[model samples]
Target: MTQTATRDDDVAAGPRASAERQGDVRLSLQGVDAFYGQIQALRGVSLEVRQGEIVTLLGSNGAGKSTTLKTISGLVRARQGDVCLEGESIARLPAHQIARRGVVHVPEGRRVLRGLTVKENLELGAFTLKDNALRRQRLEEVYALFPILHERRHQDGSLLSGGQQQMLAMGRALMHGPNVMLLDEPSMGLAPKLVTEIMRIIKRLNEAGTTILLVEQNARLALRLAHYAYVIENGEIRMQGDAAAMREDASVVKAYLGLGD
Candidate 1:
């Protein structure tokens, strides 16, 4: 099926199809479908992240979790359905255009510039801005949030530890001044201690008023930090609800989260 067709299916299947709407939503994905060649990667995945809330998308590998983030960021164009930022459709916008609209995507693998200094990488993030003072101001803010990057400002991003590189990636995204941050596997490739540290950062960012749409394989941590969440499987959303409720759901606990009954 095409992107639009898939999105339509998602709208029909979504749990909230008949629920009474409430609160201000920041990002809304209605019936979004994505494909890689002939194989469908995402099938009608509908979800929402409300203003000032941390919403987690939890699933196993190949469950279309990353595809969902890419579609929302305009890195992968949806074949069907709409991706709305505050109720305005952005599906057709280019990736850079979408970024300009305050939707910053920190992709999986923490794609930091290995050759550039931490400060230089951050400067590149503000390329869309013309005002030097504003860019410098934002850079200071990111440095403040991640003091290690400031301490190693002159060091190349490649020289930082994995945890520090992840922090740098997040700081680079923040330099863009996004209203909604789409984080894909922010806890990937980290030790248990580092994972906890990253999760704490996610929570802290949300608490400080940044709306986040987090995709994670660490379902336990994701749900713990999220206000609302969706569990996606085989390119479709299998379950969704308040994060606490999902944590209590037997299927969610046993399957995606690897928790005992």
Candidate 2:
């Protein structure tokens, strides 16, 4: 079973502060279907992440949440639908191509390079960019958001604590100035304090104009940060609505939030 983290003290109980920051659809998956060899992972999954919005996907383990993200980032090719970025079809593009188009995926497990310095790992994220000046500018931006990474810029990426690695993973994605980011299970395996810190940073990222599609294990925390949400179950989207509404939903409370009087 997938373990879920509870909301930090700072995570509020209602609508996110950035609820009004939504814009036109920045990314959309229309009836997307994906498979691994013979096993179907996503069935007619459709969703949207509007510009400047923090949208989250909530579900249990093996509920196709990660697969939905993979499909958007082109890590998993869609067998029968469209993955559109700003109204352009990108379902058939390769993962690298999708990333170059500013669809960054910060997958689960942190995935920091074992031997590379923190700076090098961040530099890898900017590989798609050709301008040296722009790369340096982005590096500074990342450092500003994660000062610890700046302190350990020369240290090995794999040597950082789990929380720091999560920051590095997120900071690395920001290196390219992504139009839309697919964050899968970011708060997994984190201590409560670190989870609070990560969620705060994620909120800051959204407030700073980054469009995010988050797949989080902490439903209450995810709902707290998100402007809107979707709940996936058994390879399909079972529910979607404004984040505030879902938080008060009896079904959501019982199944995901575990809240009862």
Candidate with maximal TM-score: 2
- In model 1, the worst 10-residue window by lDDT is 1-10
lDDT of 2 by residue, 1-261 (tens): 344455445764434535454579999999999999999999999998888889999887889999999888888899998999999999998999999999999999989999999999999999888999999999999999999999999999999999999999999999988999889989889988888888889888887889899998878778778889988888999888888778767787567534432
Candidate-wise lDDT, in order:
0.81, 0.87
lDDT of 1 by residue, 1-261 (tens): 101111111111112211333458999999988999889998898998888778889777778888999999998989988999999999999999999999999999888887999999888788888999999899898888888999999999988998999999899888898899999988777876777777778777777889999987766656656778888889999888877667657776787655553
Off by over 4 Å in 1: 1-22
lDDT for residue 226 in candidate 1, whole number 0-100: 75
Q: Give the TM-score of candidate 2.
A: 0.93
Q: What is candidate 1's local distance difference test score? A: 0.81
Superposing all C-alpha atoms, what RMSD in Å does each candidate have to the true structure? 8.0, 2.2
TM-score of 1: 0.89
lDDT of 1 at 7: 16
